[model samples]
Target chain A: MKNIKIRRLSKEKLNKPALHRPQASIESMHKYRTDMYEGMIAETVVVRGHGGTNINAYFARPLGPGPFPGVVLIHHAPGWDEWYRETTRKFAHHGYLAVSPNIYYPFGQGAPEDVAAKVRAAGGVPDDDVVGDIAESLSYLKSLPQSNGKAGLFGTCSGGRQVFLVACRTKGFDAAVDCWGGRVVMSKQELTAKYPVAPIDYTKDLSCPLLGLFGEEDQFPTPQQVEQHEQELKKYGKTYEFHMYPKAGHGFFYYDRAAYRQEQAVDGWNKLFAFFEKYLGTTD
Target chain B: MCTGIVENAKVSGSGKGPDGWYPLDQASVSYDHPDHAQSGRAIIIDFLNEAVGPKARIAVELTPESARNLVHAILASLSRGEGEGVRAKDEPPQ
Candidate 1:
C-alpha cells in the first residue's frame, strides 16, 4: 500500500472565491444573501484520512489570513445544512481555519438539503464510523497550511454529540462544543428505536473537556436526560459543561426554521465562542 | 461490499523532510482494499513482519509513533476477511 501523502493546503487556496457574475447582480442584491451562502471557500475534494479512506470535507480559512487556528465542525444528524455552513463561516470569521466534513457524503452525492433523506436511506451506520469520519476531517484540517497547528471541535444536534466523541477519541481537538446532543446509552432496543440509529451507550470513552447546551423542553431528550448525561460525564471525571434553556425546543439555534429562538441561540453561540477562545485560543 | 485480498504492501515513512522517520519509501501491496493503502496502517506486528519481510526496514507517515498501532489494527481487519468480526477489535476500551 502506498503511504498517503499528507499535503498541506496553502492559505491562498483556502479563500472563498468572489462570484460577481453579470446577470446575478440583481439576484445577489436580494435578501437570500448570496455572499453568505455562495462563496467557494473550499472545494468538494477528497483527502486520505484514517483507515486510508477518501474523506470528503469543506475547508474554509480566514478572509485574509496568517496561520490561524483550526476547527473541525461536525454537522447535526440527518446531515449537513445551512446551519452547518454558517457555523463554518462563523469559525472562519473568528480567524480559525474551519473544516466541515460531509460524513454522509459517501451515501449522498446531491446538495446539502438532500443529505438527511440520504442518511435515512443508507440505514443506520455505527457511531464509531461517524466518529472515525470526524477524525479524518481533523487530519485533513491539520494538514492545511492555515491551520496554525491548534485545533478544536464544534457541532450541533448529533454533530454536537460527535464533538464530544472526537474530543475523547482523537488527539487533534483541544476543545469541543456540543449543542443539544445527548449522551445516549445505546442498547439493542434503543439502537433500533431511531432510524440511522444512535449508539448513545458508548460515551464512556469521552476524554476531553466538553461544553454542551440543551433545550429544557426537547421531547426526544428531556432536561432530565441532559442532566443525566452531565452526571455521567462527571462520573467519568471528564471536564465538561452542560446548560439547559427553559423554553427552547429542538432546532432552536436554527435561524431558518420556525422553531428559531434568536435570544437563546445567540446566548448559546456566545458561550460556545467563549469556550473555544478560552481553551483553544492559546493552545492552537 | 468493498472487499479485496492482500496481495502485497510496502511500508513508507512520513515525508516531512528531514524531520520524518528514517529510510523512506517502503510499502505493502494489497489487491483488496485499495483505500487502506494510504495510511499504511496494519493490524498485527507479525502480519507486517510477514508482508514486508522480517525486520525489513519500512517508512510510515503519521504523527507520533502510534501509526504502528493503527497499522496493526488495519492489517488485522484485512486478514480477517469481510471485516465483520473484526469490528470488535476497535470496541471502545472499558
Candidate 2:
C-alpha cells in the first residue's frame, strides 16, 4: 500500500458557528469523505398544488432508501427556471429530498421566460394561491416514503418573501430560510387586492424557526425594513437569526448573474445549511 | 429585489412573435429582474394579446440608461412624424 498524507481542516475554521447557537457547532458538517457513497436523481414530477390543481415540480433526491429531511423551494420572481432546478439538486446533494414547484403553471407555458413575462403582466400570482401551493408541497413531502417526517422551506428574492408568508400562514414546517425576500413589510400604499396584508402582520402565527439572509445594499427589503421585521420577531419571542452582508445586493446567490457575490453567497449558504440541519435534521 | 412596479396600457398594433404577426391588445412595462439581461435589474416591456395565450407576445429587457435613450428616441421620432403631417387628429382607439 502507498503511504498517503491527509490534511484536516483546523478547529477554528470547522467549529465556527454561523448563527448565535451557543451549544451547536458546524464541525464536520461540511467535511468531505472519499469513502462515502454519493448519488442523486433529478427530474420533473407532477404534484397537487394550490386548489388541487396539478402542477409540475422539479424533484431531486439522493439514491438512498433511508429517511431524509425534505425541502420545498419557492422559486424567485424570474419564474421556475434553470437556477431553481440546480438549487433543488443542491439540496438533494446535501441529503435532502427537495422539490421546487412551478407556481406559474396556471398562468401559461412555453419558455420559462415567456411564461414569467405573462405572469408579470398579470400583476403576479395571488398571495392566497401561493400559500395553498406551499402548504400542499409540504404535505407532499411528508407523504413521501423516504421522508423523515420533517421538512423545511427555502426561497430567494420574491420566493424569499413568500417563504416568510407561508411560514406564518401555514403550519408544520420545521424550519425556513428567507434570502432577501421583498414586500414582507409593505406599507399602506403598497397594499393591493392580491397582497392585501403584509407578512409581518402574521408574526404572531409563525410556526417555525426562521433564518434570514440579506445584503446591506438591497433596496426592496432595505436595512430599515429588516430591522423592523427583526423587531417584530423579537416581540413575538420567535426563534430567528439574521445576517446582512456588506458590498452585496439582491440576488447575490445567483452565480449566473452579475450580482453574484462569491464570499457572501458562500457564507450565506453555510449558515443556511447549518440552520436547516439544526431544525430539520433526520431524526433516526 | 423585485420592484413590483408595473404599468399597463391597452394598445392597438401588430407585433411579430415566434409564430407570426399578432394583434397586440395590451402592453406592460415593469422595473424588475430580467430573465436574460446581464444587468441585475432592467426595464422590461411586453407586448401581448391575452386572447392568443402567453406565447403571442414580444418581450424586451433594457438597462436603465438604454431605456432612457429609447424613450428619448421615441419622442423625437413621434415629433418628426407629426411635423411631416402624419399625425392623426382623432384619439387612438381605446
Candidate 3:
C-alpha cells in the first residue's frame, strides 16, 4: 500500500501540481496544486444556538478528509453576510472545516444589512447569548466525524471581541484569533445591560493560545487600548501574540470595504494561519 | 471598528422601506462603519417601526459632510416653513 501511494504521488507530480497538497507548514497553506482533486461542500444549516434556539449557520468542509481541524467563524456586527460565507469556504479550501453561525437570527431575517441594523438598534447581541452560541458551535464542530478533535476561533470587529469573550468563557478550543475587535476595554459608562462586563476582565480565564491582529489607526480599540489588553494578558502570564499594522484601521481585512489594506491583510492572514497551525496542528 | 455607540429616540413619522411605506416609531443615530457606503465609516440613521416588523425600516448611510448638509437643510426648511405661517407646536403632530 505504501509503495502504491508513492507511485500515485509520483504520477501526479509528473502530470501537474495536485489541487490538494499535503499541509506541511504555514507556507503550504498558501499554495495549491492544480492537478490534485479538491472538493468542498458549503451550505446553510440549522444548529442549536444560545438558549437552545435553532439558529442558521453556514458550514463548509473539504471532501474525503481523514481528519481535519475545525474553525468557528464569528460574523462581525454586520450580521451574517456573503463575506462570512466566502471566508468559511476559504478555511475549507485550506483543509479545515469552518462554520459561521448567524448570531443575529433572533433579530429576524432579511438582507444582512437590514438585520444588522435591527441588531444595532437593539444594542447588539448580549454577551452571554453570544458566548452560548459560540460554545454550541464549538461542540457542533467537534461532533463531526472528520474532525481531528481540535477547533479554533476567528472573528473580526465585534466578532473579534466575541471570540475573545468566548475563548475566555469556554473550554476546549485549541486556538483563537481576534482581528481588531473593538470595545474589549470598555469604560464603566460604556457598559450596557447587554455588555455588562468588559471582556478584558476575563483575561485570566483564557483557555487557549490567542493571536491578535490590530490596525494601529483603529479608534475603538486604540493602540493604547491594545496596549492595556496586552498588559492584562501579561499579568496573567497568558500565551499570545499580537501584531499591529501601521497604516491600517479597524476591519482592514474586509476586502469589500474601503478599509481593506492589501499588504497588511495578507500579512495578517499569514500570521493567523501560522498561529493556528502551531496550536491546532497542521491539516494533513 | 465598531464604535458600539448608539443613540435612540422615539420618533413619530413615516418612512418608505423595501416593503413600501410604514409608520416609523423610533430613530437610531450613530457614527460607525456603513453597510453599503464606500467610505471606511459614515453617519448612519435608521428609522424603524418595531410595531410593524424589523423589515419596516428605512436606513441611510451618509458621509460626514453629507450628514451635516442634511442637518442644515432640515433646520433651514423648518425655519422657512415656520416663516410661512406653518404652526410650530410644542408637541409632535397628532
Candidate 4:
C-alpha cells in the first residue's frame, strides 16, 4: 500500500441525496412474447407480497412444462420504470417465472416526475422493508403449483444492489444476478432513509452464489468502485462472478433508453440465462 | 460504499461448482515491486469507458477464505514481506 496521504477536501459541500420516485403503478396486465423462440408462457397477476404489498408480477412458463424454474426480478431505484416491466416480459419469453416488485411503494405513486418529491417529503422507506417484500414474493412463488419451488434473483441498478443484499441476508434464493446496483455500502449520514438490510455488515454472511454485471462507464458507481467492492467480497469467502461491459453505460440493458446497447444487453442477457441454467436447472 | 465478493472454488474457481479456492492470477496482478509480489498490494487501473473512451480502473486481487482471511492477509503482508507473519503457527509435539 502506498503511504500517499490522499488529501480529503474537507470544505467540499456534501452531495444532496438524489430525489427518487418511491414506487410505480402495479398495473396487472398481460402480454405475450413478441417472437417465438418457443416454450414461453405469458400472464400477469397481482401478488400480495411483503406483508401484503400489492405487487404486479409476471409469470413466463416453459412451453410444455408441467412445472418450471422461477426467477424473482427486483427493479431499479427509479421504481418499476417501463424498462423493468419489459425486462420481466422478456424473462417470460425465456423459460422461467419472473416476478418484479416496485420496491418504492407505500411512500406514494405517480408519474416519475412527481414521485421523487413525494418520497423525499415522506422521508423514504428503509431497505429491509423492501427486502421483506421481496422475500414474501419468493414465498408466494414457491407456493404456486406451477413453480418447482426453486427461485433465482435478478435486478438492475438499485435492484442490482438489492439482489446482493438479499443473497447475503437470506439463503432462500438459489442464485442471484445483479446488474450495476451497488448501494450495499451506505454511510451514517446516508442512513436517513430506512433500509431492509445492511449489505455492508451482512455481505460476509452471504451463502448463495451471485453474478454482478456492470457497465464500465457507469457514472454513479464507477466500474472501478464496483471492482473495489468485489475485492471486499474476497474477504467474505462468498462466491461471485462479475462481467464488465466495455462500452456500456448505466441503464445500458434498458431497451427504451438511448443508453441501451442491444449488443451488450443481449450479451448480458445470454450470460444471465446461462448462469441460471447452470445453477437453477433441475436434473430430474 | 464499496462492498463486493469474489469467491472461487478449490479446484476450478467458479461459484456454481463444488468448493474450491482461487489461485490469484499473479500474472495479471500489478505489484509495486516485482520482488515484493506478496508484500505490497497490487493495483490495476482500468479504463472507465472501456467501450468508448478509455477510463481508469484500479483493482487488486487476493485470496483468503473469508473476510477474516482477507483482513489478516492484508495487515500481515503490509507490515512484513509476503508470508512472514502469515505462516500458520507450528503445533507442539506430544
Please give the DockQ score of every candidate, comma-separated: 0.01, 0.50, 0.48, 0.02
lDDT to native, each model = 0.55, 0.84, 0.84, 0.56
Candidate 3, residue A185: Cα displacement in angstroms equals 0.4
Q: Tens-digit lDDT track for model 4 on A170-267?
A: 77888899887855665554454455344666777776778877776675457556656666676676677766666676667766555677666666
Complex DockQ, candidate 3? 0.48
Candidate 2 interface RMS = 1.7
lDDT: worst 10-residue window of model 4 chain A? A1-10
Summing lDDT over every window of 10 consecutive residues in candidate 3 chain B, give the lowest-scoring window. B84-93
* Best candidate (score: DockQ): 2
- C-alpha TM-scores of all predictions: 0.59, 0.88, 0.88, 0.60
lDDT string, candidate 2, B30-91, tens digits: 99877679886799999989999888879999998999889867766986976644433453
Ranking 1 against 4 by TM-score, winner: 4
Angstrom error of the Cα, residue A161, model 4: value is 0.8
Query: What's the CA error at residue A276 for candidate 2, in Å?
Result: 0.5
Off by over 4 Å in 4: A1-43, A52-54, A63-65, A109-117, A120-124, A196-198, A282-284, B1-94
Better of 1 and 2 by lDDT: 2
lDDT of 3 by residue, A31-140 (tens): 56777788899999999899988999999999985499999999998879999999999899888889999999999988898789888988999999999999999999
Which structure is stronger by DockQ: 1 or 3? 3
